[model samples]
Target: MSLRTKFMLALLFTGLAAVAMVGGLAYAGMTKKVDSLRRERAAEHFHASVTAYLAQYGSWEANRGKQGFDAFMRSRGPLAGDRPPPPDDERRPPPPGAGRPEPRGEPPYHFILADQEYRVLLGAGVYKHGELLPEAARKNAQAVEVNGRVVAYVSPEGVITPSRQELQYLAAMRDALWFGVAGAAVLALVLGVLLSRGLGRTLGHLTGAVRAMHGGSLLQRVPVESKDEVAELAAAFNAMSEKLARTHEELNASHQTILTQAEQMRELSVRDALTKLHNRRHFDEQACTLFSHAVRHKRPLSMVIGDIDFFKKINDQFSHATGDAVLRQVGEILRSHMRLSDLVARYGGEEFVIAFPETELPQAAALCDKLRAMIEAFPWHQVHPELKVTMSMGVYADLAAGTAEAMLQKADALLYRAKETGRNRVCFAA
Candidate 1:
């Protein structure tokens, strides 16, 4: 069942059990007490009457058998309900709520009168007249004394009929007990609903938040509506969720930073530090890919290796700073002049390499010669009056060279031939 229902049931059962046990015990004890009081009153009244009868008649011998005693008992009103009330002049009005007059019926209490020798004179239906009373009954007999001497003993032992007021009292207690049980049940239900609403609401919020977090939204909050342990639990859960969300955010930010740094590190690994050009290793790896594609498709691919003429002497004479500037400018020029499909990189000191896909040998030679002219024509006077720069380039276009590495070697050999021919020139084999 629901939490509220379960709580209500538990509380209700507990209340009912408590009320039942206590009420039952009280009723039983009160019943026993009332029965004892009734028997005491009956015994006292009977004892006095018996003592008066004996005192007036002088002894048990005055009344031989039950016939004389019955006559005496009839005069004295032996049965309470059997006699009419005494004349108004002689009788006082009974107290209110004490009880109504007893109905004419068998009396609940029976008294057996015994003399000092323990012979029964009045059995009240339990023994024959003049019979010896039982030992067990004799133990409970109360002494009836008249004029400072023991007269007789009477034992009052029988079912006790409760008075109307007594019945009313017991009934009132029983009704109150039932009322208390009902009241307890109502209180339990009310408390169950009130308590369960707060607890269930908080738990519902927590469940929803956990599901949302599982779905990738890491942030959540729940209400803390009480100071009880359940509320503390909710508060703890909220704190834990907040911490988890914060931790997840931090982790994501760290992950992004790591990715950015990794990209920068990878770019640095493949780039020439001075000119920011593709280094020989990156170029070589890419050139192999390009060569594979060209050979597979039987497409045009041109390879070129270029060297700055007398680069050592220029660095030696113009200072290495100027040589670096020259190299930076040349790399930028080549990068700008090439198609997006072309690959270019600084091969080593004062040397550059290029790969032109979808380009024939003649077109490659023309582009290289143009590069040579541009280098020779640049404003050398700006660096130093005596400084001059030129470049020699060699181009080769042949898939028969096998791997890109072998093709690059052929281009290098051609580059040596160009330098052998003269500085500031382009050479190719068609």
Candidate 2:
């Protein structure tokens, strides 16, 4: 099932298939060759028998009188009626011109007399007597001549023929084929099993390593015991796994860095440059969320909008550096008095905004009054020793407010009114 096992099985099967195919073809070819050789030998034997029989017949026909030819022809069996008699028979002292006695009913002898040229002469066989030869016997038959006369004859019984030799060779080939196939099959099976076992063991180790990797054990590796390809594959796999683990760690670190940078960017976008407090942009975004929560959860929310009194006069009298220090001090004081849940932002130059969740307008106004009194009492000249600062504060509370914008507008209106009435005072939105 594992890669190594699969590979081994693939190789085993491929070898088996190739061997089987080639072995089968070899067996077939060998069978054909052996059969051909056997057929050739059988043909030789048949030709030898036929030749020997013809020589004896020819000698007897030439030397013996008509009696010998008659006896030989009779012993050999029938022939066609058109065959001429032997020369010895032809020279017989027959009644002058008695016209060769009506040849005995289709003479027992069948001979084909040769022409003066002594080439192949007429021939006959049992076939002419209406006796059909077997395929093997027919193939064994050959034309011969007796005393320069042609004859057709077949080998005696038990003589080898092409078909018989072919059958014998085929039988031997079948036996050999079965033996080779069985031996190959056994060998293949044994090799396949042994290879499968080795492969299975290797794959088992790889599988275990993979499972460990899945379980967060990145250091796990497959065991390698050889210098084969599987070992190389294991090494490569381990390298890849290590690389992936390192890459994953790097990606995680990068993700954390991005998150940190994003948080820092958010802070930078919303903080006042001099005061280091939430600027107007942050106030707008947070105020909307706070307002929604107050409306949905029925929680009181309050806002305090304040402006530094005579801030431009202070900057003009001293310097921008002094003005900046004053703003920084005010931001510090505000932050010190606020709880973690409260938000304080520098709304604009010399203006600050404060938000309180679950605080009523009266509580927010009282806190602003406290902040005003503290600023008035504190010695700003300790650091500058020459500057004095005051702020006008306005407070508003959520009453299921028309909108966050409307609430901020109301608070801003109060802040302006406080500044108009006096430079340092706290006002509340009715």
In order, how many clashes per candidate? 0, 2
For residues 1-430, what per-residue lDDT tens digits would candidate 1 score against the true structure? 7665676678778877887888889888987897777778777766776787888887877877556655565566534433343454875556998787643323445578888888887777788878998999988988878788887888875445565566788899889878877887788778877777787788788889899999998878888988999889889988998999999999999999999999999999999998888999999999999999999999999999999999999888889999998999888888888888889999999899999999999999999998888888989888778888899988889889999998888888989999999868887885
lDDT of each: 0.83, 0.71
For candidate 2, write residues 1-430 as lDDT tens digits.
Answer: 6655565557667766776787779878886685455545544443443455457755424635335544544444333212344554555566987776654422422332222233222224323223444455544445455566555443332322234344666677677767766676677667767767766777788888899888987766677767888788888888988888888889889999999999999889988878889989889999889898999899899988989999999899988888888899999999899999999999889999999998887888889999999987779988577778889988888555577778888889998889788769999975
Per-residue lDDT for 397 in model 1? 92
RMSD of each: 7.8, 12.0
User: Which runs in model 2 stand beyond 4 Å of their true positions?
Assistant: 1-141, 153-176, 201-220, 398-401
| Alpha carbon RMSD to native, model 1 | 7.8
> Highest TM-score, which number?
2
Q: Estimate each model's TM-score.
A: 0.64, 0.69
